[model samples]
Target: MPTVDAVVRCPIAPTFRVSQLAGMFDLPPEPHTERRFQVELPGLDQPWQVGLIVGPSGSGKTTVAAAAYGRRLRKRLRWRRDRAVVDGFDRRLSTRAITQALVACGLGSPPAWCRPYHTLSTGEQFRADLARGLVSPGKLLVLDEFTSVVDRPAARLACHAVRRALDRQTFAKRLIAVTCHEDVARWLRPDWVLRMPEGTLTRRCLRRPRLRLEIFRCRHDVWPLFAPHHYLTGKLNHAARCYAGLVDGELATFAATLNHFRPDRLRISRLVTLPKFQGVGLGGAMLDGMGSLLSEAGAESITINAGHPAVIGHCNRSAKWEFRRLYKTGRKPSGMYLQHPHWKTSAGRAVATFRWKFS
Candidate 1:
């Protein structure tokens, strides 16, 4: 067994306004205080993967983690205001690795990756930070105030994504999350949990909550909420049926399915998972669910037109979907062009199109 001890102390000003206010409340006007963090491990047989320190504000979570790990603990990610999310990672890592890391952290949108870090939403920025942290070379990664800024659902999904990413790492690295939110404990499933204030430490056998997804028909007006996340520019098809996938009553994925020119064929034109909920298989699940629904409704087959490589790859691997063809610029494919004709690649060439048929 290994033991660790940490002690933190700081001086306070007795003559300050805070002290005067404390006097009015009949509280102690102490000039200094000390906090201790002591722990003993049961055995050195198994390697620790994740350590969590949770408590409310001013509970000394940061101080204890810093004292215990010191320079080995990476607390804050270095960020450039104008740099793209992909460019913020370590230069030594390959582009593929960086992209995988970003996607693993739930920032999977192509448009989101190209934008400057400062332009990202609060949730996107949080995931970007986690992505960078996950790829950086470090043995002890300490994330202070984990999920403190995002809403509860985003935080939970982020925790799940990060945990899965960490599990897939080929190297030996330990993660320590210092947070006030205990709701993520189930998703994080940390090997060790250190509770501040009470100073309680426990080894947990946590299981991830089964995500209950509810797919329901939604109106076309819901398109605006998910349109910004889509890589291509387009308006919703007038004849399309929009569907939303909700997890715990929160919107997680959206899709637009429209009937093809032939009465027996249906095509999925738009499929998008919200930024916070990406990389969780929600988009694929929604597509499959909607396809099954239409198939049972007498539709012979369903088709999907996708430009993203990730979506294309997923379709190529699924047994229910078959790759129809790939079309480049200046070429007309067999099926009708669901995407706008004006949508071209940066090089003025037609973007690579991947078509899949699902039954």
Candidate 2:
């Protein structure tokens, strides 16, 4: 623990009018003077995953971090304006590692990945910058102005996505997020927090609040909201039953299930979670809820086969989901097997089928 006692100050020449105003307001005679910070923040060189340095704007937050961290703090990252966002990651990293970093930082949409960084939405660019910063292997990664460019809800939601990303790491790595917004601290669930001005270090093992989603059958018109996030085509099946999962009255996930050749059988057509809620298994929750809805409506067998890596991982981890089979996407079945409807929707990639039931 480096008990920092740094003095933060800037030169000020109070004019006669300013001095008179200060005296009128009973303010300090020598205004805007230096202040000393004795922060007991520790564990920069130690083992940790995520930490935060947060306070109000102009509370000497950045000044304190610079005094303690120095060159380790990455204030800004330069991106190629002409290239796609996916291409902006460090060139030394493998494709898998790059994609993993993108997923971890909540930039999970492949379409957005292919677009130039400057063309993305503010929230999308924030996640992309975080992904680029985290893809490199290091013991410490310091980010300043964390979540400063987005709205309050988006900032909180992105924090959860970032938490999920850091939690997935099996290797040694850590992040120190510098921000002014305090609301995101709980959502980020940081291991430690260093409050500025006060210079207080509070070690915490905080957890983000549990979010429950209410599922409802929604109109197909709402698919436009989720289509941009999906990797597949934006088109939904004509007869597909659409459903939406909401958190706090906002749509967080969208899913579509189609009736198979047999009335009792069902196949999931599309399951998409908004980028803000990605990497937290809401997509799987949408699937589970849709299965229950169809089950009550006379669906005896609800089968799902998705191509997204996150979707596949979620299905494998869920007790309600069981592996049915795996087959090449380009393969064709002969005779009676050719009648299976699953082959019609997914092609050109390997697909794993799973059966869903309440656990």
Candidate 3:
């Protein structure tokens, strides 16, 4: 149980206003010329994955963290303004490796990867920063002001994504998040917590709150709310049945099912999970639940076509879904194109098809 101590001193000019302000308010004058902080942290004897330094603002959290892990503490990241978000990563990291990090960190949209960091939303930028830093060779990462710039929901989901990513990685890495907001601790569920200013430390295994998503059939009017987040941007199909999944009264997933080739054969035509909620399996749940609905409604066959590797991988591992076929997407033969007569072409793309049934 090594203890770390930090002293913060601000040179005072001792002006007239300073002297008067000290007497009236906590203006830092007269008897109080310096602030001292003492923090006790666990030594390297035990294994730990995550740690949190949390308290109110100006509570000496940063000072304590810097004293303990100065080398890992970084105030800001320099992202290239002229480069895309994926291009801003280290040259040693392959595009696939960088995109994997981004996906694991909850910034999974392919379009966002091509856009510069400045063009991303605040939440997206936060995840991108995490992804870039997480791929580093360093064993330790010190994050200050964690999730401070994003909304509460984004903060919570980002915490979950970070926890999942760290747990899945092979590297024996550790992360220490320094933040003023204490709410994220619930989602983050760090291995230990150090409350600043007073320097209180607690070590315990904390469980993340289990989230339940209630999926239900919904009207297409809700599609607009989720349209922007979909990988393929398009209007909801009028002939398709739409379903919505809600978590704590907030919509988190969307799916549109259609017959496509035959009215009796069902297919999940469009599936989208809000980026923040992607890794949580909501999209797959929406697909399965909607497929079961149609199955119960007398549909003879059910299928799903997926292009994303993650989704395809999930379906491959699931017992409920069986691999069907792979489509070589491109401009089809003129004779074949005449049969479908689709306006847009998916040239040079590969899509995996799967059939859904009771496991």
Alpha-carbon RMSD, each predicted model: 4.4, 3.5, 3.0
TM-scores of all models?
A: 0.81, 0.87, 0.87
Task: Output the TM-score of candidate 3.
Answer: 0.87
Model 3 CA lDDT for position 232: 62
**What is candidate 3's lDDT per residue for 1-359, written digit by digit as tens?**
88998898877787788788788986544544588898789876778898999999989999898888887896557898999998988899888788777877888677788899999888899998888888877888899988889899888888888887678763357888899999999888898999977799999757887778787889989998778766665666678888888888998988888774688888787788787776555666777777678788888888887776557867986778899888877335464456766533345677888998753
Better of 1 and 3 by lDDT: 3
Tens-digit per-residue lDDT, 1-359, candidate 1: 55667777789876778877997999877778877777653333567788788999988777777766677555456678778878888889988778777777788898888888989988898998887876678666788888898999889888887887677673246678889999999998899898887778898848988787898899999989999888786577778889988998998888887776776777787888989888666766776787777787788867776666557646765676776656554245333343655432223333334343443
Please state the error at residue 104 of candidate 2 in Å: 2.3
Tens-place lDDT per residue, model 2, 1-359, is 77777787776678988888888999877646787777777756666688899999888888777877888788667788999987988778777777777776777788988899899888888888777777665777788899888988888888887787678662246788999999988889998899976878888878788889999889999999999888978888778888899999998999888766777888888888898787566777788778778888878899888776677777888888899888777335554456755545455678788898743
